[model samples]
Target: MRDCCLLFQGGTQLPSSCLRDEDVVALFEGRLPVSVNVLAHHHAARCAACRTLLVTLAHGDALPSDSVPLALLPLEQGRRCSRRPSVPDATWTPPAVLDGFRLERLLGRGGMGAVYLAQDARGDRRVALKVCVALQPDERALASFATEARAIARIQHPNVVTMERVGEVDGRPYLVYEYVDGKSLAELRPPLPWPRVLDIAVGLAAGLRAAHQCGVLHRDLKPGNAILEPDGTVKLIDFGLATFVGSGGTAPRGVREVVGTPRYMAPEIRMGESATARSDLYALGLLVFELCTGRLPPVRRGACAAFKPEAGRGPAALLTEWLPGIDPGFAAVIACCLAEDPSERFAQADVLCAVLEHVRRLVAFQRTSRVFPTPWMGAGFPPPKDEGILAGHNVF
Candidate 1:
């Protein structure tokens, strides 16, 4: 091992430990740790994957014009790497079938894999199948799929997407989940009516409760991960980033990585702390705020740490400020979820679920009695300069 004290050594030797995907990302974003910054550059110079990764990341950044998509380049290497630019290839078609499921079409894709809507002929049902199609799947990517399969396999809930099967297709791990026949919460145009928002929030809480009861904590709980059926049934999907609840639980895939979606991550998680059920609730609070206002909470440096919620100064007050004439009781519910302090947030998912249900009933009753507090409040939050932040997706 090299000496940690070599503050500015012009090191030429490669570190025995290879740089991870996160390390590469941090290095590109200028967030890499100083101790290994030199080693990362040296390793990237020698490693084909890392060099290609830098190019891809650069293409995604300011130097995008420099990128020559794999499709445009050539088919010399058929491997799909996350670092590659995503260029539309009209010629590319879905494989007819994989294992037994008939691939209908591509639903979505990520750095490591693609999810397809498929037909489960034997079961006479439809399923969403996630297949790891990475050209040369890395250990972390494979471990993610395996961990997701195991995590979802252990929990069964109406609100949470149900897993049908787990197996490998051509050496790549694939997971089959019961299809929701609908779009994600994100797909449903934001600033949905307040009542509808409450319904989705309640369903999400129930799904989270189920996961928590099974000792699973969804480290990432953004709207995109929550699918809504035609009838508005919220089905929480994507357990790839989930972990067993509690401090003593084993790390995900036995690898501890703080690679959560920054916008949805709780303050503690952002500062490199273990995730908890409360952290998931914090994300829920952000989702609810977006649903109500069609925008996310501002992304300020050390936001949560700075905003210590006092009695009247909690998240509710801000919600009321942004959305005039909103129900105070309902605003308070979301405020509790957004509390900067974990201890101040809901102690359990079940508790939050019950509180939301109560609010829903009260709103319905008030509406029937013609005493509703607000007229389906969704009037505030002007469009942000960057539309990406429109749907409450302010990344830190």
Candidate 2:
């Protein structure tokens, strides 16, 4: 019982303990030779006096340096006589899916969930995380919410914000989404350029087309839900209120005011009629109007109002100059979308996408004679030297 410590002391001697020299080496190897590792096996085999000394060394009250040649181990083992890394306080253990994602800040909150900005582990990429709270809702509402999550998970398009993963922790749902880097169209204070407006319109049309192809409809199509990513990409989000075109609360089938915001709501949606694909188109047209003119289409007192020439002047004027020879076509398309009769609008999102592509070609044709300055260059931005917009501004 006295042999263990004596065997380890001064680099060699049998101690008044039961642990053999071979047992001591085995314990050291088990700990990977880390300093101050508690000799559990040796203690279990030792007498009371030897056990007490081992306990003191394990607790760090007594140094094992004089008894053992631990200094020959790694620098870290020699420096700290501790069992584990020094953790000052208990920290919140993040969910497994969010292991290395550093939560930056809460972006916004809605009825279904909250959005947060976080850094992805791999490349430190910025991403948006939508975490759903298990709030007290009726069974029907909860089912609908889950359905929305599943529907969005099935969609894939460059213009639609991609759902990375869906995680459930403690009965709460969390959605990981690709981060869109630009401000919302509604948040764009001034009127946007015709080209930029068309760009967003084309992207939105493409995204909606994909959703429609899969038998889905974005009941709520508003500027607020569209974002321009930093890479000049557009993405549409907030599908929590969306539903299958003919299923759930989608118009022509259900009675609830299921999707869409008031300002951009189609006449059908507002009238308690079934929201159709055309209803989504109508909302998209309204968003286009907002982007081009920075004005909301006026709705009368408790009813859809007539397009008053005076009130619609801002957007109308911009459209006039921007459209030129192509203005009538654009106006006609928008008017058709906003028609009181859903049947009068474009039958499918693909048709709308084609129409928008044509508009882009028209813009390119119209700008052939004169060069329009880059939109970002208007506010004292450096112009392309090769493009000859500046003098001696060598950007290369």
Candidate 3:
């Protein structure tokens, strides 16, 4: 694939930022020099085009939306200005076969495109293929498509869905992913057993932490993005709205319009600010709250909808009113995640994972021994102040 960065330089297809198919093939085969291999991986970590090429060459598959209100359009829309076709989701017919993969059935579609369960005859595996069938290919749609493909490529964790290849059919952009066999958390009725909830919380936190460590921020984290496997694993998916943070850099300072689901949005995000790690956590907090209880967290309905963080109710109070029999400590951790102020939330996903791990240990211990333990029992009392969860104890 040609480098997008070079297109603006007199429309020349130069190898400025993107990797060539040959180099990617060598890199995938471990035939590149050590220095070049390191550099290629680093570039792939941040360059969507190169990453797409790398994944395509690695899996050996082939080659590689904007609209209403901008924000309400879909998380995949990039900030670039481009003319996009308005192909309604209901109007398109699924191609019988795309890039050697047979379309088995329609999974779902949104404002930007549709996803299908496809059969990869060569690989002998079922793959989830996402195509811009509804939007008709355009710059915005292409950018969003590559954005998700590149984002998932940077992250290598079992909890995150794996990207197999990137190719285009009939001038439309499409991505192939490992088809997950379980349902998303959004499909399950809530009020799950506390133990199960805690397990899901740990896995979800670990997954987010992996993404954060890779410098990829999932701006649109919600229950639907998390799929629960039969063995109780939560795999995080959908990075179309994800943002990559460069060294010593942050996400775009602001956005032209709000993105992500309004109910799952953080206050800052609703106000048109760039999403941060803390903001992602805020969305995660909402997700966990809904998982623990059967309903969503409290939100004010008005000109601007936002969470009631300062509302006169603590985590314990929430447990009493919304979810009884749940450990207040766990609730406190979720509250800390949903802090109204960005500075007040967990510093990063790993810190959140550390705390959740500790809570799981505490819960397991308490289940066997009914005896009231030490001061750690009240570690989550009141509310956590910043990294206060680790201030008094050695959580390492």
Candidate 4:
């Protein structure tokens, strides 16, 4: 067998012993770093068997793993391990096996990972690939990746950003998802139109319903992860902090502790308790609050907005003003979704769906009533004033 030439940029080399047969096995099974092009080059030059393994890793055509998301992994090893890899060179080119996936550019990164815009060469489709940081090869990061993949994989909804595949090349985990060519709600300038925002919320609620049906919980739901596609689709992405319930087992050992984004996290998660369906609902409600009022939910010491009709009313009154055309029952439903207590929120997605349908009807009713001029008209033709759902149609 030819000796493998392990290429280490900046003179960093993995001891030959570190690249053991067991490590290779783990690599083939989606448990190794998938982003180390240099390592792949080295392994290919030395071992024909490992070269073949490189092809497999590059193609990423393997079956999906039964493993849970990496968030659920044991973080102790990650915290204690000192095996961080050097960051890739800016001009590095990945091996040929990754040929089909054209990595066009880099996207913004988060605490756990970075995102890239890539294309599916096979289908001429675009995708967003999220690669976790390889620093230290922490077990906790691995578990988070695995957990996200497993939870999102179970959900199939048009409004949800779907997880297409999961791959691990060297020692790092990567997630492949359908590329969304729209800005996140948080990134939109001047905010979104009221109708558009409501549409997004409806679409998001629909996806959440599907997730709940599949026994999955989106522990962290926020505008930052809500994608608005060019074609007007609202997609909920980033399940990194989500949890899978009734998975026919207990919560993964590492994930049992509190995990989720702070701003959108439910009180229970903040309290270090296990997340439930209602927890997800609470997050969604918080998201709705942000979308409707251009602000966050009432935090400590903040006065709750009054339900008054004014140009710059707080979220409560704003919703009351624009939502008058909606049935009172549906308004109550939205209120219930925003309940302070998780238990008081809508427990099931179906209930929210019913409320949304009613709101849609009200929107239509209000529109028709304006166009046809009613018999109850009082005097001379009055100047047309913005009313109903259309009142806030020009959202940024």
Q: TM-score: which candidate is best? A: 3
Residue ranges of candidate 1 with Cα displaced over 4 Å: 1-94, 246-256, 303-313, 371-396
- Residue pairs in steric clash, candidate 3? 65-140, 65-141
Model 1, span 13-108: residue lDDT tens: 433334443344456556556777777666445434446556645543211111212222222245222233333232223367888889988898
| Models sorted by TM-score, best on top | 3, 1, 4, 2
User: Per-residue lDDT of 177-279 in model 2, one digit per residue for the tens?
Assistant: 8887787665677467656777888888898888877667777677667887665677888776666754332444543342445456566554456667778
lDDT of 3 by residue, 170-281 (tens): 7778899899999988889988876788899899889998998898988778777889999998999888878788653247664344556555767776555667787888
Name the candidate, 2 or 4, with the larger lDDT value. Answer: 4
lDDT ranking, best first: 3, 1, 4, 2
Misplaced by over 4 Å in model 2 are: 1-100, 121-124, 134-141, 246-252, 300-326, 369-396
Q: Judged by lDDT, which candidate is best?
A: 3
Runs of candidate 3 exceeding 4 Å displacement: 1-87, 300-304, 309-312, 374-396
Higher-lDDT candidate among 1 and 2? 1
Overall local distance difference test of candidate 1: 0.66
Predicted candidate 3: what Cα RMSD to the true structure?
15.9
Candidate 2 lDDT (Cα, whole model)?
Answer: 0.55
